[model samples]
Target: MPLLDAARAVRENAHAPYSRFKVGAALRTTTGAVFSGCNVENVAYPEGTCAEAGAIAAMVAAGETRIAEVAVIADSPSPVPPCGGCRQKLAEFADGDVVVTMATTAGQSATLTVAELLPGRFAADHMGNG
Candidate 1:
């Protein structure tokens, strides 16, 4: 999809000097707007932001939430899945059914729902948001 293409394009802009592992994410809001982000690494260590988090920040800054779809791209031997933290972050804005497309620079990909990536999510119902 176009969102996967966008994520692939943004992967080139990642500032990953430390790990040299660039990652990019594209998030599609329920309103049909697409936002993209590239990972930014810091010398300080461990505080670097994930591409998914950055994209979510941009989406929220634009007053959009409820990610209907997500795409993440990285140059890895296999499709790079988001870290545990990112999966949770994604779950915060996306439901169990939201698609999460993980891709490699080689164009290989795997698509799974958010629940498939992170089952038993720590979401609103657990917090009584219902």
Candidate 2:
């Protein structure tokens, strides 16, 4: 299935209520497996999970640590960029040049790299210490 089709299909399962902003993400892993996730919102705004995060969680749960491609879709006029936390999480599994595709409900689309989305990201290696 096309990336867009996978994203659109997953978007339908989004559990968004407060924001009514549904998002979906499909990630292709280095193991040739595709994992899909949908945004799950909570009453507490900060507790909500982004689509990309969910997809990564699913991949990790399945023991897949590397991502080759990721496609995110939302019901917006323009492409929705991943949040800071999601960007950091993505850097853990995907390198700077990993394909990052964004799409909107109206068919608008854009592509970028993890590095372009989050420049100078601090990874686990940068943890602990001054």
Candidate 3:
């Protein structure tokens, strides 16, 4: 749960004044490098950055791809997984079976694979990458 802990720590920096709903994300590369990020909301309301996107940006900035694992934490009754757009964003770096752990600040958590979280996801193969 160290990843979740890291995410929770960054949640304090989340800029979510609009919704007052803060979120944090932490991701581990296959090489074991960890990157963390917090959601930054915008006044425009619709166009806001997600915690997962921030973490992915950090990971890419560190010159790494291929997410081996991910952890997301939020202050909710149940563990909240990444949003629909984030699931696609995660798929860009994570494999179908990559582990994604959703956690709540209250200690509740749920673990699932990317495939489980986003079944029938639009993957690289669909884009003819192969």
Candidate 4:
């Protein structure tokens, strides 16, 4: 549960004002390094950064590429899955079988693999190499 704990701890640091919907994400790299991030909203609305994206960026900045596990927590009635774009971002680094756990502050939770979250996801192989 360290991943979840990391996510929950970071959730408190979210910068959500307009939507007021805060989210936090934690990811474990294959090397066992853990990285966490919180959602940061922008005044421009859709230009905001997602918790998952932030975590992924942190992982990359730390020189880790493969994600071993993931957890995301949000203040919602039910476990909130990552946005469509976040799902793709996760897939870019994590394998299909990588587990992604979504949770609510109230303790409600759901789990799914990257493949389960995004079936028929577009992959780099889709683009033929020159």
Candidate 5:
């Protein structure tokens, strides 16, 4: 299935009682496996989970460490990009050239590479682990 379709499908399952702003994300791993997730809200706003992070966690739980492509969808006026934290999470598993597609329910969409999404991204090398 298309990543966008997957994301859209999962968006319906999002637990956004507080914000009512549901979001969904899907990612294709380097191994050709696809994983998807939806935003899960909590009473404590800061405890809410973003769709991208949930997708990444699902991918990691499946033992896939590399991402090839990603797609996210939301019901907003324009395409919605992942949050700062989620962007960094994506960078942790995807190369700079990996494509990230952000979309809106209205059909608007934007495509960018991970590098474009998070320029000057902090990496493991910054921790002197590389």
Candidate 6:
């Protein structure tokens, strides 16, 4: 399925209530596996997880890493960029040039690279700083 179609289908499963901001994400791994996820919110706010994180979690749960492409969808006029936390999380499994596409309910869309979304990101290598 096309990335947009996957994102739209995943969007239907969003469990958002507090902000009423639903989001969906689909990721295609280098191994040719497609994983999808939707935003899940909590009344506690900070416990909420973004769609991108959900997708990554699913991928990890399935024992797969290294994403090649990712698409995100939101029901807003402007394309929704992934949150800072999500961006950082993406860097853990995707290369700096990984393709990230964002889409709006009205069909507007934009594509960017992981590096473009999160510049100067700290990754696993930074954890061992001596």
List model 2 lDDT by residue over 32-92, tens digit each: 8899899999998779889999999999999899999999999898999888999999999
lDDT of 6 at 56: 95
* Model 4 C-alpha lDDT per residue in residues 1-130, reported as the tens digit of each score: 6899999999999999999999999999999999999999999979999999999999999889999999999999999999999999999999999999999999999999999999999988789641
User: TM-scores, in order shown?
Assistant: 0.95, 0.94, 0.96, 0.97, 0.98, 0.95
Please provide, for model 5 over 69-112, each residue's C-alpha lDDT reduced to its tens digit, 9 standing for 90 to 100: 99999999999999999999999999999999999999999999
Lowest summed lDDT window (length 10), candidate 2: 121-130
Tens-digit lDDT string for candidate 3 (1-130): 5788889999999999989999999999999999999999989978899999999999999999999999999999999989999999998899888999999999999999998988888876788995
Model 3: colliding residue pairs: none
Q: 3 or 5: which has the higher TM-score?
A: 5
Ranking by TM-score: 5, 4, 3, 1, 6, 2
Model 4 accuracy (lDDT, Cα): 0.96
lDDT of 1 by residue, 1-130 (tens): 6999999888899999999999999999999999999999999988899999999999999999889999999989998888999999999899899999999988799999999999887877777895
Worst 10-residue stretch by lDDT in candidate 5? 44-53
lDDT, candidate 6, 50-123, per-residue tens: 99999999999999999999999999989999999999999889999999999998999999999999999997
How much lDDT does each candidate structure score? 0.92, 0.91, 0.93, 0.96, 0.96, 0.93
Compare the candidates by TM-score and give the number of the best one: 5
Q: lDDT at 57 for candidate 5?
A: 94
Off by over 4 Å in 2: 128-130
Cα deviation of 89, candidate 5, in Å:
0.2
Best by lDDT: 5
